[model samples]
Target: MTRKLTSQDAEALAVSALVYVANDPVLLPRFLALTGIEAPAIRQAAREPGFLAGVLRFILAHEPTLTAFAEHAGVAPAAVGEALKALPTGDDRYLAST
Candidate 1:
């Protein structure tokens, strides 16, 4: 049986996505450029609120990237959406609250 996802699981998925981006030669530059987060500061930035959500958003922004991450993480692409929703700062949550 499939286990229900929790906030912790979502955080883990986001962390995985961050790691995936960090290790990629191509994606890493883009991620850093877009986020303006230096490689040396990434660990510090990861502790900031909404950072993980941003990582997931970055991954979800591109179909190929999303597919690659999903395949690498052994999860359905849809799970990224679920993990986004599980995050407190997810765009969906902000939209829902507003």
Candidate 2:
């Protein structure tokens, strides 16, 4: 049976993905290119609304990245979308898959 993730769980996954991207040699470059965020700016950018969900969405855009992060985070791949929904950007919507 597949497990569902709570909002908190999704938040955890997004944070974990940030960590994962930072340590990764390959994915790191992709993140920087896509987000136009340098390594030094990650901390500050993370504080912005929908940033976490954007990270999750980036991973979701690529199936392999999504699978890898899900495995490392110990969460069902589908959970990422749920997490985005839970994170209220106060008007800025974060739609992952649903």
> Top model by lDDT, which number?
1
Clashing pairs in 1: none
Candidate 1 lDDT, tens digit per residue, 1-98? Answer: 56667899999999999999999999999999999999999999999888999999999999999999999999999999889988878855555543
Q: TM-scores for all candidates?
A: 0.89, 0.80
Worst 10 residues of 2 by lDDT: 88-97
For residue 67, model 1's alpha carbon misses the true position, in angstroms, by 0.3
Minimal lDDT window, size 10, model 1: 89-98
Scored against the true structure, residue 28 in model 2 reaches a CA lDDT of: 94
lDDT tens digits, residues 1-98, model 2? 75656667767778988899889999999999989999899999999878888888888889998888888887777776667666655124543455
